[model samples]
Target: MRDAEYCFWHSPAHKEEAAEARRLGGQRRRRERVVNAVYELEGMTNVGSVQRLIEIAVQDTLGLENSVARNRVLGTLAQAALRVFEATEFESRLTALESVHERRGKGKR
Candidate 1:
């Protein structure tokens, strides 16, 4: 799943904000690799690949040791992680997503 974003900018201020998202989201293709590596090494069964990676990342990377708190943090990170791998395989799935968004945006001209 490629998490991609397309923003509509009607003003210069919005354009600047969009630029920031674009810049930060650049090279987000690494999410799949990092998450995949974590799951493979940890052998986490219950968590999906994305969630497993997020759990390890919160613990190992963020140094959250408390299990309960770690889970909460991991949940937040899981949401963020969705953005981390944007458009890695974007071109393939993008057309469908774009089509849906396009149809919605252009309804009943």
Candidate 2:
């Protein structure tokens, strides 16, 4: 067995350890999937996703016992929420402008 080319973890002497490692790895992956499903934070393609993330951060930070760290995190979340609001406002305005332009173009034809 000493002359075998198998790696330490793959060797027959460490078969149980290898099996346990594989089992733990699979368990971790399943847990992550469940957490991701619960949070739905995989693909943040829209403002709603960003808002949800900020909301979650704010909620979690509120429970912190350290005031300084809590306030810092809350401040950051506030700024992120403000930025998202601004972007939503801008998007609404741009959409309205595009609608007007489309209507004017139709009238010209």
Off by over 4 Å in 2: 1-29, 40-42
Q: Per-residue lDDT tens digits of candidate 2, residues 1-109?
A: 5788898688988899899999999999999889768987764788998888888888888878878878888988899899999999999999999999999999999
Q: Which residue pairs overlap in candidate 1's backbone?
A: none
Query: What's the lDDT for residue 23 in model 1?
Result: 74
Off by over 4 Å in 1: 1-10, 27-29, 41-109
lDDT for predicted candidate 2 compared with the true structure: 0.88
Model 2, C-alpha of 40: deviation from truth (Å): 4.2
Q: Which pairs of residues clash in candidate 2, taking residues 3 or more apart in a chain or in different chains?
A: none
- Predicted candidate 1 versus true structure: per-residue lDDT over 45-90, tens digit per residue: 5335555566567668467556877677777786766655553346
lDDT of 2 at 84: 98
